[model samples]
Target: MRIVVPAGGIGGARFLRGLKAALGIGADLTEDDPTITVIGNTGDDITLFGLRICPDLDTVMYTLGGGINESQGWGRAEESFAVKEELAAYGMQPTWFGLGDRDVATHIVRTQMMAAGYPLSAVTEALCDRWRPGVRLLPMTDDRVETHVVVADGDGGRRAIHFQEWWIRHRAALPALEIVSVGAEDAKPAPGVVEAIDEADLVLLPPSNPVVSIGSILGVPGVRAALERATVVGVSPIIGGAPVRGMADACLTAIGVETSAEAVAAHFGPDLLDGWLVDTADAGASVEGVTVRARPLYMSDPDATAAIARAALDLALELKGDRP
Candidate 1:
């Protein structure tokens, strides 16, 4: 089966491992691989040290490819900071964002590829050539759409900062008055993105941060339309009025959304999501248009994560009324 998974960082990457395992088991295949297509969020992309660093995309790529720092949930394993330290010694500013040397190598390759007139989708495929993640990973768009947050700076004035700066540097301490995808208005979806959604047997939205991650990816031209027309299911990132991880509350609040499953469902609405999966804890959250199923949502371990993965797909299948 062809599956199109729209995911963000960390949580999205973790669920994929289970999904890969489940598909293998279900098919009775030795090699647990599916024709998976991942539409990764590029909102976390930041230009640091004159290189474009896509954190969410890299997180998914490395995690699935066995190159990620498992504990940190991002960046490379056995990472070194030699380059960062050297740059710091030269008195570089904005040292708040951690870019290790190995991670820098990724950025370098991405930059060089882009400079060679390749779109981000093509560049990512080329990079994944070595990772062999057993899936086709595509950026939502190759356009220069950046997610920026309007926050109150230290000067007691409001200004829009890059999503990375708002999330990493200040750690979402400051309230975000606005979130904007700077180039989304004109950005078109990547080459295979629309086709993947249009032809997907199932579309899964993992428990990724809603606002900047999935939301930003959706901000691109054709994504929301594709989801609106596809067999789509979304797992809640917010459980019991709080996110299981990350500072999603800040971004949710920025758009006047309360940190609740109900609010998130309203934010995404039925136009995009056909089935919505929440934790058994938030089973009471039901709406008119979407099918709501309750189950454990925490990825505390592989078994637990796999259960949620099953719940997510099972709910999708139940809604679609398909055994496979």
Candidate 2:
């Protein structure tokens, strides 16, 4: 079996770990091994100190490879921030974003490879070669596509800022006028991205930020068109009325979507998604032309998350059978 997942950062990474467990990849089993391909969102990629940092890609790689800090759910395990501290001591600007010593090495390698003229996909593959994340991790696009937020400048004007600046520095506290995926229109999917979607038995959209994560992936030229051909299932990031993790409500509001499970499902629409998974708290939630299943959606641990992944796969299988 083949499964293709379009994912973002923390939530997507955690859910992927559970999905691998559910597939019996980590277990001592030989049968029912599925080839999983993760299309990671690169819209969050940023250049800090002239080093490229692919946050979502690294989060997925570290989380799946068992090197992610379990507590914070991002960055390296047992990490030290001496580099960041020293930079701050030197009176550097933009000190709010923390870059740990171990994580710095990743950025160094990626930036070096990028400077050598390799595309982002090749750089990501080289990084994953060491992590061996068990899945084929591919960037959504090799082109430089960034998510920028247009927000009030407090001077009766608006200015565009990187998504990380609005997210990390301001904490999405500033009201957003628009969220733009800069360069998305001209960007093509990374190598094997469209093919992975085209050849998949199932496509899974984990509990990632719809506006910035999955939305950015879909914003790539042919990604959404390719996804329309597959049996797609999505797990709602919102539980009852709030995000399970992170400030997804702010992103949803920026995109003018209601922070409800049903609304998110409708936003993706029935044409793209065949089945939708919602939390047990939203049992009565429904959307037209889409099969709805309510289950315990809290990814509290690997076991709990694996159960949710299994439920989504089962629903996809059922939906696949129902197709004429």
Best by TM-score: 2
Each prediction's number of clashing residue pairs: 0, 0
Q: What lDDT would each prediction earn against the true structure?
A: 0.87, 0.94
Candidate 1 lDDT tens digits, 1-324: 778898899999988867876665322233434677899998788888889898988898898888999889899999999998888899997888889889999999999998889989888998898786767789988888899999776788889999888899989987888999999999999899999999988899998999988898889987999988887889999999999899999999999999998779878998888889998889999867888888888889878888888888888877777433
Residue pairs in clash, model 2: none
Q: Report the C-alpha lDDT of model 2 over 5-75, residue by residue, as the tens digit.
A: 99999999999999998887862334567989999999999999888999999999999988999999999
TM-score of each: 0.95, 0.98
Candidate 1 global lDDT: 0.87
Clash count, predicted structure 1? 0
Best by lDDT: 2
lDDT agreement of model 2 with the native:
0.94
